[model samples]
Target chain A: MEIVRIIVLALAGLLGGVFGGMGMGGGTILIPLLTIFGGVPQHAAQAVNLVSFVPMAAGAIILHIRNKLIRFKGALYIIIPAALSSAGASLLAGLTEADVLKRAFGGFMILLALYSFWSEFFSQKARKAKLPAHDAPTV
Target chain B: MNGIAKKIILLACGLVIGFINGFFGGGGGLITVPVLERVAGLKTKSAHATAILIILPITVASAVIYIIAGKFDFGYGLPAGLGVIAGGVLGAAALSKLSNKLIRVAFAAIMLAAGIKLLFF
Candidate 1:
């Protein structure tokens, strides 16, 4: 069981790195594996997932930056509020019920998968709904 | 998915993953691993380890913020982080040889299974 846990956790990290490189949350993979396969508690699994994410995000961000795909303006706009919320939420998660959180987390994943499925399989609708092009007017 | 299409899907997933990471602290792995394996055709181990490597930056940055704000618990984080580093390296090596489809299928099945388990079991 220990060996299995190690292998699974390691495999989770590897998957996190590769998919993370292509721009995705490896946690979506890691937490479930940790909880179900590795027999870890939900809180511990979530914490581990967050800790593991540090390196993975760094590598992917560097790649995106190297490719000139990162927009600092956009990143900042998003990161500030997110950072604050995450910190606040992390604390809240500690007080929250574990099973409730897990179910909530599962619901979140379901929504995300549904969104991904919709975007991938029915992209015509997305394109039609895409934000319209806007040009800044010169003063 | 075709190469261009796959990339597009990955990017879309990336945006969602990024938002979740920024707001939730961990989402990329949960989100990306399956996409890379199922949509982008990456091997499972490769996809998993790669997810960790990629998550490092964002999480580190977030960790920094947390640390600065006195939210970090080094006693807990440091010991586990050592394990993560070792695990990360092993996972990366394993990924190099696995088949893509197996990776994707394994990822998807785990996700659905976990989701179901969490919901009812």
Candidate 2:
């Protein structure tokens, strides 16, 4: 039984890591699996996801650096503020209502997904057709 | 934009991304990549790479806070982290073979599915 549980968690981690290495956040998949399938509480699940993310992200970051993919100068501009804000926000999250946070996160995810799909597919097609998209920035 | 102005904007963007990452556990890349490309003038590949680097520190900071606050559970997190490390290596290697369009599509699909699951169930 213990081995089975370990295998399940490991598999989930592998799935999350694959996505994380692809520049997608691992916690997106990890958190849900932990909470729903592993029977971990929501807050604890999120915490575990965040904790696991560090090493997974570190592994990916090293690879990206070795590949000369990272833009250090540009990254520096973002990192300081990001680190500071993340510390502040995380503390706030610990205090906020869990249900409210979960719902808000869900809404945010849906909106982000729709926007990403539109930008990747519809906007790209418009660009190929030489038509201007109102808000889509060609990246 | 001037160099200083651009730096400021990037910093502000970072603040927003970090806050979201802290509030949620993941999903920072969804915003990071676009901002890097559209606002910072990075190419798509560069944006993706830079986003990972950008996320590393923010995630570390948030993780630390979660740990200090007694939110983290190492029993499960440790095994999962180890697995993720292995998977990260494989995924990075696969990047050379996989097309960017395919990755984008897969990412979108996953995000959509996750979103629906969270919202409805």
Candidate 3:
């Protein structure tokens, strides 16, 4: 059983790396697999899921930085408040009603999924409409 | 059934999967829970605890790398972290009362949509 879990972890890591490189939230995959296939409880699964984000994010961050994919200026605007607020939120989560959180979480994921789809659709359309680099005016 | 096996399994899973999570962001919590519950024979609570333990280290380590490179955004991370931490505790408390299966199904449906979005739109 332990061995099986080890194998699952390894496989999950690989999937995470590939998906993360693409900028997808590998957590989507990780959390579900852990809960359903691995039999971990939801809350514990979430906590453990948070723990695993560090290393996985590091590699992707490096590549994105090198490729100039990261927007630091924008990140600064978002990260500070987000960090402070998230901590507060976590504490509040400790205190708040459970059912509300569950529904909210579920809704959040659904919205993200929809947004991702919408963004992709627009991006594709824009790409199709795009002109050659030299022909297109600079922004 | 035993302590050593559980710890060992957890550790190994954390190391390899954590690395993947560090690298890709795919496996961590999603994979950890099921492995802990089914393979390690832990209850839902125990599995959740195990998952959190794994994530704490992995997230910190990855964040450190970004920090060293001067790319780490305290702003983004902090807010997100704050939200997550607050959300996490709430989620944690809710874990016992709510149906994880329902959450799983919802998540899966969302993921499917996300995946399709990735593929087509």
Candidate 4:
């Protein structure tokens, strides 16, 4: 059973990596896997997820770089301020009760999800409609 | 939008993203990807890839804080770290092969699940 737990943890990481590599944060998936199945404590699960992200992000970035997928222009606009706020926020998180923050974030995610679905389908339909049906597939 | 407005949005969004990443201990990408697409004018695949870059420093900064706080455990972190690294490489490579539409739908589904889980669980 201990072996099973370790394997589960690794498998969770694997799935997390795939998701993270795809540019989605793996922590959402990884933290739960560690907590629910791996029996990792909430704090520890978070720690593991954050720490694991270093290598995972590094690897994914390398591949993304090769593909020219990482848009570096104006990145500093986000990164500089974000890094500062995140550091401060992480420290504040350590000191505060997170339930309120967590709830608010949950609402944000739901909104984002709805937007993604709507935009994807609507835009695809619009794009399709704009093109003549007889146009050869531009490869 | 224009230069100043875009900068403002990016900075504002980054601040929010950082707060989410820090408070929740991860998942900044959920917001980062969309912010890049809508506010920053990044294409779909580029937004996904760029989100990681944007989060890396934030992750590292918070990770250092976690380590300093004695929150990290090598025992469990090692195996999972290895797995994640391998999987990340695979996923990055696979991104180019997958269609943008498929990626969008997949991301949406995960976002929904993640939202419910965060709210209820």
Q: Which one is best on TM-score?
A: 2
* Model 3 complex DockQ against the native: 0.04
For candidate 3, lDDT tens digit of each residue in A1-107? 76675455445444433333332345665544544455443344444445446544444455445654332321222223323333434444444443443344444
Worst 10 residues of 2 chain A by lDDT: A130-139
Can you tell me which runs of candidate 4 are displaced by over 4 Å? A97-112, A121-139, B96-118
lDDT, candidate 1, B7-120, per-residue tens: 555556655655566444576455555544455444444554445444455566555554554444443344445555555455545655777446645555556666777777
Instruction: Compare candidates 3 and 4 on TM-score and give the better one.
Output: 4
The alpha-carbon lDDT assigned to residue B99 of candidate 4 equals 88
lDDT of 4 by residue, A99-123 (tens): 6555555576677778778877767
Alpha-carbon lDDT of model 2? 0.76
Candidate 2: tens digits of C-alpha lDDT, residues B1-121: 6777887888899899989888887778779988887677776777777787788788888888888988887778877778778877777778688897888677777767767777777
- Steric clashes per prediction: 51, 0, 54, 0
lDDT of the structure predicted as candidate 4: 0.76
Best by DockQ: 2
- DockQ, every prediction: 0.14, 0.56, 0.04, 0.51
User: Which pairs of residues collide in candidate 2?
Assistant: none
Question: What order do candidates take by lDDT, descending?
Answer: 2, 4, 1, 3
List iRMS (one decimal) for every candidate. Answer: 8.2, 4.1, 18.5, 5.7
